[model samples]
Target: MISLLLVVGVLVAMFVAFNIGGSTTGPAFGPAVGAGAISKPVAAGLMGVFFFLGAWTLGRNVVTKLGSELVVDTGVFTLTTSITVLFFIGVALLVGNVFGVPASTSMTAVGAIAGLGLAGGVLDFAVMGEIVVWWVVSPIVGFWVSLIVGRYVYDRLDELVAMERSEGPLFTVDRSGSVPVPRVHRTTNRRELAGTATVVGIGCLMAFSSGTSNIANAVAPLVGSGNLAMNPAIALGGLAVTVGAFTIARRTLETMGSDITELPLTAAIVVAAVSSTLVVFLSALGIPASFVIIATMSVVGLGWGRATRRVPAPAVVTGDGESDDPLREGTDTDATEVPNPSALFDPLTTARIVLMQNVVPVVATVGAYLTFRYVPIFGF
Candidate 1:
């Protein structure tokens, strides 16, 4: 019976870990993938490696916090608590999957723990308070940081393009004969700023942060029961999670990246940077925060900022009798050209997508909880 219980617990942990990978890989790799900076398979491969590294190196702190520190003076963590927490996380992941919302593993895990603690007379308000504070602050900070950086960086790039265009191409056009001839500049400066290098760096950082923040989801329960040492647990858990993410994370990524926000390269990179930073910080502080929520919110905020900037005003005639509305007489004569590609997917659709992302986890959690709760044959 003891062996059976341990097996069951480990299985549950694996399931939770798989869900974490599915939900997290999108945020880690979506920007790079959407930007065409890397292929999906390559991103997945890189994510698997960095995720393992992050989990092994930084995930330990989050696992300790979840497994041992949330509740106070509890001699033995009941199987009931572990099962309950697992059920909640599973439910949350299911919800995210169904609605296309990238549910935070950290949020669901903490919520489950809090719920069980409340039921078991082990609720720690102070700890809960701190977690709540960070939850609110992390996303907000990410949003503003992303907004500032995205606007500034993109604006600079636009200025450079404008300047280059104004320079008359450094060539001469001749129409002296029946055929028009154009002369091209033999010498041109090639700016080699290593943009790809920066992208690779960000990708690495995002992958590492994802692995570290997600370890708690898969290994915390085992670690909590003192059945597995941290190092070995992380190694095994990281491997399993990486494989699961690479295999099944695409569905969640589509829901978050395509359905929620039509992320351009700039927005995607900013979101990735901010989300990765927030998750790494939380992991260091021994807080289990949701990477999905953090990343999702960051993307949404960036999109929203861009959208507001693009709100259309009433069309007016200029002094030269030309329309300022690009849609009317733009160089590209496509009538359906959307100013903000992100606006193509609105909040309503995004909400629905996010709803799908979250629904699967909720159902799974509820089912697991009920299975453990009502099945007397198992002798829970």
Candidate 2:
């Protein structure tokens, strides 16, 4: 029975990891893939590589926090209890996937674990408070930082970063010498090649960020239970994530790439950079960052900043500007009429997306609490 329960716990943990891979890959690589900067297979390969690097390095700190520090007593993470928490996390991931939104894997995992701690009377309020505070603060920081960038710097960067794909292949094999050398295609300019590299690099960064924080969500429960060691747990979770990146991530990639097609590649890159940085920083502090919310708020902030630039001086107070029209198109203005590609942000759709992201985590929190507190099988 003990062996069976341990196997069950590990399987559930893998399920959580698999769903996490599917959920995170879209946000990490969608922009590059959508822009034709990289293929989905290449994106998946990068995700696996960078994710493992992150998990092996900074990810261990987060694992320690989740598997041990969140609850006052690690003994609470019995095989049965671990399975219960992992199940809630997996369900949360499923909910996010079903809704075509990237779920807050870190938030849901922490919520489920917190539920166990609360039910068992071992909850650490101070630790939880600190994490909750960072969660609130990080997204706000990402928003404001992105807003500032969009309002002031995005245009300059947009002009500099040319992400337009050219006709034919980006590289060609030159077989003139004894050894074949890959050379840049004649049709592809330097700026375009640079842009492609930038998009793919940012995608790798996002994957690393996801690894630093998300690995804990999958394996923390099992590790806490003492049935699995940290290294093995991380390896197992990473493998499951890689599998997910190759399989279920396909649909998520399409959703993020096509469904939110209006968002310019520059804006996506900006959001990814800002959010991924924050996530990595928080993970260093052993805090689980919610990338979905951070990225969403960053999108809204970037769009709002870009939109407000067109408002007349008097429009700030009287609300008489063209900015009131949320669905307004085109980037022309009296100033320079610079090509503002990120003016397509829609507030209504963004609000709905934010609402759903929050709802999934909240549901997981409540469901975990109810299950652990009342369910006789868990024996909390």
Candidate 3:
């Protein structure tokens, strides 16, 4: 029976780790893949390597905090509670995948632990309050920062692209007296901004941060059991989880990058940079926060702000080539042609995505809480 229970616990841990990989990979790789900055296979390879580094190096701190420091006794983490938490989080992630939404690993993991703690009569109200406060604040902060930066950067690029388009291509002549070849005048402003340097830098930082920040999710439960030391377990778990995420996260990345927004390379870069930095900062402080929530909110807010300023209303063309819609007669059609708001910033989709992401954490947390409250009544 003891051996059977150990197998069950290991299986549960593996399931949770797989889900973490799927959910976490999107934030690390979505921008590069979606923006055509890197080929899919290359992105996957880099993601695997950097994610391991992140998890192995910085993941230990987060693991320690979530596993042991937040609660009173690790002994309370029985196989039953571990299985229950695993089930709740697994179900939540499956639901999100079904609906084509990206759920958050950090949120689900922390919520489950908190719920279990509450049910076990180990509720740390003060610590819970701090976690909640950060959860609420991080995304808002990320959104505003992204919004401002995205606008400035995108506008400048737009102006530069316009300039390049207006001035025709340059020409060069060969010494052999052959026909003059058209020299490609690369737009330094827009094109250079999204070049290799920028992409590589962002990719490295995001992968590192992802690995570092997500250590808490996979190893927290094990860490909670006082029989184990926190650092080694966290390092091993982080490496394993990062590998899993790099392999399986592609599906989730497709959901976030294409389904949520038609992210241009520059905009995606900005969002990743800002969101990853925020998550990393929180992780360094040993605070449990949601990278999915942060990245999604930042991307949506940036897209929304850009859409409002640039997206024009629909119009009907008249016989004489005039617009029949009075409201849109003189509006800018160049910006409106792409259907930016409708394609990328649909309210229903945004709400659904947010709901799916939050549900896993919420349900898992609540279930753990209830179990903790009622387990004694069953005479366990």
Candidate 4:
């Protein structure tokens, strides 16, 4: 019966990992697909590979932290408790996919683990406090950094990355010699090729970052229960993510790809790079990072910065390019101009989105805490 329960727990963990794959693949490869740089299969394949790399390397530290340090008593994570915790995570994922709202799996998992600790009478306040603090801090930092970028250098950067794909396939295989080599098409210019490559490369980077942060969500509870070792758990979790990427990520890919294509390629790259880097940094320090929150904040910062810019009008001249006051009633042609209000960002919409983003984690946290405290389903 013990072995059977452990097997069931691993299956539940895999179910959570499957959901992670489906949700994360879209954000990682959306820009690449939007730019027509790569196909869904390629994106899915790269998502699996880089995610595995991230899990195999930086993701382990987070597993250890979550499985060992969050609770004061590491022994609290019995097989039954682990399964109960994973059940909560799997429910959160289901809610996210079914409702079209993207939430932080890390946040949900941490919340469950914390709840389990709290109920067991051996919770570690210090580790829990630190994780919560970073959860608030990361999103704010992302917003401010992106805001500065949007305000000062957005247009210039936009021009710098003004990319348009030319006609025909980017490369063709030639079997003229003993080996085949890829030959670039004549119509595909250098800039277009470079832009495509950059977009696809950034997608891979996002995949790596997601893998680093998300692997712990799936396997940490089981590892805590001593039902599985670290590497095998990671391997199972990574494989589950891959399964999700290939099978369930198609619809999200279309949706996110379309939305991202409406923006400038550079903007997409900037947002992805900034958000993914933050997640990776947090994951390296044994923290479960929230990818959705950071990405949303970064996007909001970019748009808000660009929209509220004040443009300076040049001076008016009669016959030559001379300094003439246009503010004067006689020569108000091009002098100091009134700044137009670029109130493009909708406050209500942003507020609602942000609010909605918090809902899954909040529910997961409060629900897990309450369930663990009152319910006897897990024998805790």
* lDDT tens readout by residue for model 1, 1-380: 45776677777877877766665677666655554445667777787789888887778998888777776744335554565567667767676656545566766676665554554456578887987898779878877765555444544643332211122233456789899897543432222113434555677788799777778877776787676678877877777677777788776455444332345555556667788888899888988776666766676676655544423344568999987776565444323323566432367755664454345444544454455446564343
Deviation from native of the Cα of residue 245 in model 1, angstroms: 3.3
Local accuracy by lDDT, each model: 0.65, 0.83, 0.67, 0.82
Off by over 4 Å in 4: 257-262, 314-343
Where in model 3 is the C-alpha error above 4 Å?
Answer: 1-4, 34-41, 157-194, 242-247, 250-261, 308-344, 375-380
Q: For candidate 3, lDDT tens digit of each residue in 1-380?
A: 34676567656666666666656566566655555445666666776677667767666667777777666766667666666666776777787667767678778878888887776667677777888899999999988887666544667744442221224222233445566554334533454443544666777788778777776676667657643356665555555565666667666567543342346656767777888899889887788768778878898777765755544446778799987765554543454433344325667877887887877777778877877677784222
114-138, model 4: which lDDT tens digit per residue? 8788777777899989998998999
- What's the alpha carbon RMSD for model 1? 10.6
Model 2 / residue 93 / CA error / Å: 1.5
lDDT of 3 at 270: 71
Per-residue error for 51 in candidate 1, Å, reads 1.2
Error of 3 at 245 (Å): 4.4
- Judged by whole-model lDDT over C-alpha atoms, candidate 1 comes out at 0.65
Error of 3 at 135 (Å): 0.6
Query: Which residue pairs overlap in candidate 2's backbone?
Result: none
- TM-score of model number 2: 0.88
Which of the two candidates, 2 or 3, achieves a greater TM-score against the reference? 2
Clashes of 3: 5
**Stretches of model 2 off by over 4 angstroms after superposition:** 174-181, 257-262, 310-344
- The C-alpha TM-scores of every prediction are 0.72, 0.88, 0.75, 0.90
